[model samples]
Target chain A: MIEKILLLTVAVLLSGCVNLHVHFPDAADKTAGGEVPTRPADAGGAAK
Target chain B: MLLRTAVLLLLLAPLAGSAAQITLSLGSLRHPSFEAEGVMLSFDAARLGEADIRLGVLRVAGTEYRALKIHCSGFYFDGRRLDCPEGSVRREDERGRDRPALPFSLAWRAEDNFLSFSMHDVDAVAFSPLVKRLRSWQPKGTIDFGLTVEGDRAWLGLAVRDLEFASREGDVSGKAILLTVAAGAEHRGGAWQWNARLDWSQGELYRAPWRREAGVIMEAAGSLSETTLQVGLVRLDVMGTGSVNASLAWDRARGEATEWGFVTERLDLASAMDEWVQPWLGTLDFPKWYAAGHARFSAEWKAGGLRRFYAGLEDARVADGTGYVELGGVNAQIPWEASSPTDAEISVAAGRLGDLPLGGFALPLRLDGSEATVKGLSAPMLDGRFVIDLLRLAKRPSGWHGEFEGGIEGVSMPKLSRALKLPIMAGSLTARVPRIAYEDDVLRLDGALAIEVFDGGIIVHQLRLMDPFGKERRFIAEVTARNLDLGMLTRTFAFGSIEGRFDADLHDLEMQNWQPLRFDARIASSEGDYPRSLSIGALKDITALGETGQPKALERVPERSGFSFGYDRIGLSCALRNGVCLLDGVAREGEGVVLMRGSGIPSVSIIGYNRHIDWEALVARFREVIAGRPGAIIE
Candidate 1:
């Protein structure tokens, strides 16, 4: 059991960790009511 | 059949009638003999001479008695050989008349007695030693297997003492050849009695990887259906001296159908000890030894530190020394709900008892069900209950809290004290309907309540109190069931403890918050739930209310120095925040009257029975309020 714990510690110290998530805002606004708004996805040319 | 009976009677009557020849059990008698019961014989003479020895029935198969190529010779108890056989069967005076007849096959020479040896099919391991001593070859070459008979009247038995057999199977000692094999009767429909016992001890053998120092004993006797039981205890030898003893007894019918659906199945490998390394061999785990009628049943098992209460699958798992619990996820059908292991969750139920800790104590918990994952953590879902120390509160203050929830169900609120071996508290109240929840600083509830306050405690029936974080702010309640003893209730509070009772509506009453600013409540203990169906003032004042028409204590204990309350029962819908209370547009001074004007004093007062205050109209005003809204104005 102690061996397993030691191995886990070694693995953690050797590598790095990651965070949960990051956020960004969208293009829609009340002032732009009814207007066709461009999106980041469209600018990347993936829109069909 | 008639021919066989006549032959058997003819052959056995002579030996049976002779007192010198005795028939013994299969396990007795070391050598072969004629009077032997079934097939067991003992040679006990000491001389060099030939005696005509009678041989028992030697049959290759039923109805087929075959003459055995017998081997008769003499040997001392020290395993020394004396002059006996030049060859196997007897030869005609050296004339080669019996080249293969086993010289003196039926004739005893010297001290050895003539023994029978029939050439019937025999297991190689059993006779390999004898064949090797004779320098016999393998395959078709083998020793005597005695005879083979077919009948339930008798059984085949063999006994050999101080027998060792293991040829040089490649440079290894006879110890390596040690193995266990058994040859017992497979009776068709009869009982077999056995007093078999075996002991395995550690201090008695060679060195090995696993130290197995233990003893086992077993005895059994029964028919094909019913079996008598026998058991034994053994010590586990680990670390040279550690040991664990065990014992069991069972006597029942073994079959396909029984009461409660009992069936046999393999025990879970995950639960088997010696399968995984345990943490803290003796302290934290509680392992169990269980016996059940069939598979798919629940059993409480503790291993070291872990424990679980589980609803066993038909076969998978059962009692986990801890317990199998889930909050709102899967076991929603269970009467008591447990929200999976949270840093915290709250509940408001009818039970006077809330988990273990009454109010805000530490509670460590685990959750289990079909959907077990505790959400984001990669750790395995806690499958059983774990302890949470209330003392750990300092560490996870905001993350863990147990707020009582739901209706108290069939829980008698009166025995809440007796049942828990707690301080005596009495009263039993029921709710028409109720529900409550607590978590992350919030507790919400709704329901009707009829309770009794007898002796000195309060009993509630329909009740609801919600404390949802700081958002909902405070809680307000109203109950109207049966008996309620106000003095007993003060003891129920975990606070420093306060005690008293009144006959009027108690507007602000609270438990579990920081301040004494209680929740607004509109409650009337009429149907004998309360001692006096009271809420307004104590007996000291009640006397004044009926006589001088005023709160008698109003003239006694001054009200918080600068504030005084003259009204015994007042509207509760007025301004209420934190601790400060307001009545109509006016405020109060410590005495029992409203301050039509202001006092230079800063702190508000909580008036109790006291002098230095008006006592007449205060009692009359109480009468007016009772005639009007009686038990109105609640949150």
Candidate 2:
């Protein structure tokens, strides 16, 4: 059990040095009449 | 029907003014609705003030009308115009049905081929055969109408009062409706152009299609054209507690809505749940969660399902009556379409959860069907920053699941302890958890959470929590603390100053509702550690662990020997199970073990003879040690 804890602690310390990055898409332009297209059909394809 | 009735009445009026006995034979007249034949008119023109006109039979559509009569009074006719002051029309029936006498007035001009007619207090409900042929449902109402026809152009206006409409097939019924309508049509240049205006008041609909509550007063105005039908606006007030404004346009050919929108203005969420949401979900109660907000919503639907839907909320707040949870100053905008990630930005200015004061935070969320992902969300917590790396929450058929990774860094332990009402402990705590996942109400952590405290490191592993949000929650974990400076730990709790290095292992620890259920805990001196000594107060507290323990040589009531005593080693263990702790000591002494062994001048030692102890009693003993009242251990 002590060995397992030591291993987990080491893994957590290693993960602390790493970071994950995410980029958000730009918002769509708003019009005077509040007309905007639905989601772009291919917007989520790259994300998936 | 109005045009045909006017022409026949005008022919009778002129004959009554001839002042001579005349037999009038009228040829057959054909109309799109019916063919009229065998028409004979006879009237004495000497007394033109009153006339009695009778027709044998009039066929309209497929229904045969027999014994149709018109009684006219104060009738006048000239070469160009005919007028009737008062008249009554009736169609006799064989079944002895009592029908109301329709009172009407008519004027006809032959020079312009023009006719105008007006009728008042017409009980159209008595025309059961015509009503049955027009619609499947029965409508009881009183109608007042006027019609004018001039050379291929027509205008009609009608009003209905006290309308009661019901349908047995649809289980729908409503009462007290008033409707006003006007329509005009012109047929010129081989085409027909038409327009209509419909206005209704005090209309309450039952069993409406969506989200419409019963007994809600609804007002609507719209117009209809040859190509499209439009609802200009519809306003509904739900018992004056909530309201909605909506408008829509329908495509005549496609028979579907082309453009539709609605805005909810200041709806009381509690009352709304009582009226709509609870009934729709078939749930009895909403668990004391409520909100009041104003929202603007718009949607466009095409041949396919949904083209676009948008909703924005402003000045929204949610809270419970008990003040346990609250959220205020919430604003959000969400836009969704077919097969696209529903990305939305949400901001909450202030909130509270279970005695924890929450600060303002903004979150960017993307939802794809059942999964939701939130990235880089951070908030201030207890003089430190609580940061989440990546959180993915999923909604499954049974319930909800989540995966979260985050850490609390550089938090002041003393401040946290004060906030949580814990025993004052001094240190700066930094904890990092790599991964925590939850499923089926059970949360599991993959990696250890390392906490730097007490000039040492404590690692927590194998942590699992069941029903964390439910009434009864259970926690299981294993903790190991190494090389903790004992002086610091002792001073933090004010548990009788002791000088040594400490190490411990707490395994198989289980707690239910924050109360310990079972654990195997052992604390002992670390190997080759520093100046080992125990204060007289500390020695007295250690001896109190057993029922009868006395180290008389260690105590100095006179204070002549100072306040300290030497000890070679000190250790104790409790293997707790079922509210009982199986006690043990460091070194074997006879059948038991010496819990504390004194080494040098003015030496002292203590032994524990008791093997079994109640876990709660041992806890109380430790509390007393912290209170500086080590009671009578030498006895």
Candidate 3:
């Protein structure tokens, strides 16, 4: 039973390693859905 | 006969006692060289009274003097001679308080037909009729002279003071002239042979591009006839400078010099250039120069054209004020003829062009008419040699044109870059140029130049330069770089390192005054690349170059193993126009472009959303990246 438990732990660790691919939201979809963040204007700016 | 008549008239006038008045009139009085018409003489008393003599016309030599009047006081005659110890001369037509009478003393010896006269404070305007060139200049001066004439010979000792004259254009002028002259003349064979010595002790004279200041003495001998004036020899001694010997033949009718020549002793180059050469160089587009040396020059001119010229220099050093050109230990002997070819040589110990230093060289030159040629000329450059197989230059009616074939061999790139103030680079540069031609202020390459640098080859085609030395200089060319190692380029420019090979194509590139104006440039990874990878620093730089703001995707990478990443391909393109660059990447990924694509584990890709960017802003960002500043985030 301890050998089987060790096998299951090894499998879980391998699965975690395999699922490590990074995921980023599509930039175009974010812009289309009005979810893109806008940077704030700096204070104390000189007038043109 | 005329002198005898004048003596008889003076004797009869004095015979009339102190209280007696006498008047005499004659139709005309004539001599071989002197004549007078409508002559009259009148006197009252013999001691204190005045004698007035008026003549409608007085002709001396070949010039006519009209309305001449001579008024005499204390006149006396001794039967065979006449003397007027106090006399004054005037012109009837002159009407101004400033026109004062000229004082004179005269004695005539009837025995030998000899005349002696001395005049004081004679205005130079009185002789303007004889010197046609002075009529428009409005000469103002006073002259004092003593003249003695016997038969066909004459002698004059003259002194001029406070002379001032100028032309309307102000190109020819003189001021504060104090001149002393001793001249002698004799008439023979219907012409006058004359010689004079002139000393200009204090004055300033300007004749167009030539100027003269005080302390000049000239001794000249010439013959003047009806049709020509020939100066046999003229020796000029200028203060602080050497002498010059010259001669000229001038045509009186055409008012031009038919032939002229001059030979100068070795002159001090510094003084000569300042006083004479600089003024004449105003029309040429050349920088101001300072020189030190001694040189001798000779030239012949005929029919208003140069016929032959010769110049020799010794131990010369010349440098421009702007530090663009300099030469030292220069010695040369150059001779040129208008109709025949001549060979010459120049040797230089050292020189510099821009910032590049040059070693010593001796070059042979050939000149004929308006053309010059140089064959097999070689000069030492920075750790290399520049060889010119042949060069030919000719002066055309439009301007100057030339052609040359040359090559640069084994020049160290690092040294060249340092000299040019560019980034330090590795390897050596070499180029072979087939031919370059220049015409109409434009220089163009007839064939492409293949240059080896950065372990690759760059072929430059359609290269042209316009007004290379002028303010509006321009350069145009197209270049193709093949298999350039990216590591070396990035290291040279201080860009983050990437291990790969790339090829670049730059088409229709143009620059004005060394600033880029337009170009279409594309850089892509070379085919069959090896070990293609980018470091973390390089990845951040690439991201900053393309994206407006930092992407959250970069933060997702595990920090433990974030040293480098493998890349499948890299590509970037920029088309510059109107101060804006239209940018692109390798391929489309949804609505963005893939700047870099990952190929292995722990790899990452960059996507660019913006397509158009300000060129100046882009360059600023690039500078910030190269300086290792934090990546800029813009919206």
Question: By TM-score, who's the top model here?
Answer: 3
TM-score of each: 0.21, 0.52, 0.71
Lowest summed lDDT across 10 adjacent residues in model 1 chain B is found at: B328-337
Q: In model 2, what are the clashing residue pairs, if there are any?
A: B19-B45
DockQ for each candidate? 0.01, 0.01, 0.03
Candidate 1 error regions (>4 Å): A1-48, B1-414, B417-443, B452-576, B580-635
Q: In candidate 2, residue B204 scores what lDDT?
A: 56
What tens-digit string does per-residue lDDT give for candidate 2 at B1-635? Answer: 33454566567665555568654544454433245565544456676556555556666535566665666787654435657669666554643136555677876676676767777777665444333332345667777888776766767788878777777666576576776778776655443344555566556555533233234555555555545667778776676357777777777667777777666666665566545554554342223455666555556655556666766657778775455577788788877666678898888887765455567888778877667898897866677766778899987886788998987777787776766656666776667778999888889999887776777778888999876654456899988887788877776666666888777788778898567887777777777749887665655556554344444443323343345656777677766666555656666667565666667644456665545555666667666556643221211
Per-residue CA lDDT of candidate 1, range B1-635, in tens?
A: 22342344345544533334332223211222222213322332333222222234332211222222223454211121123332243222333333334332222222333232243323333332222232222222222323222232223333222222323342211121112212233334444322222322212222221222223222222222235332233222223222323333334434221211111133332332332222222232223322221122122222222122223222222222222212221111111113333232222111111232222212222243211212211111111112221111111344433433223333454444444444444444333233343445444444434444544233332233443322234544432222334445433432112232322233334533323343333322223221222212332233333323443333343333223222222111122233222222122334332212212122112222222112223434344433423222211
Query: Which candidate would rank higher by DockQ, 1 or 3?
Result: 3
Ranking by lDDT: 3, 2, 1
What TM-score number comes out for model 2? Answer: 0.52
Residues B549-605 of candidate 3: C-alpha lDDT, one tens digit per residue: 544555654454336667788776766665555556677676566666666654556
Candidate 2: DockQ?
0.01
CAPRI tier for the interface of model 1: incorrect
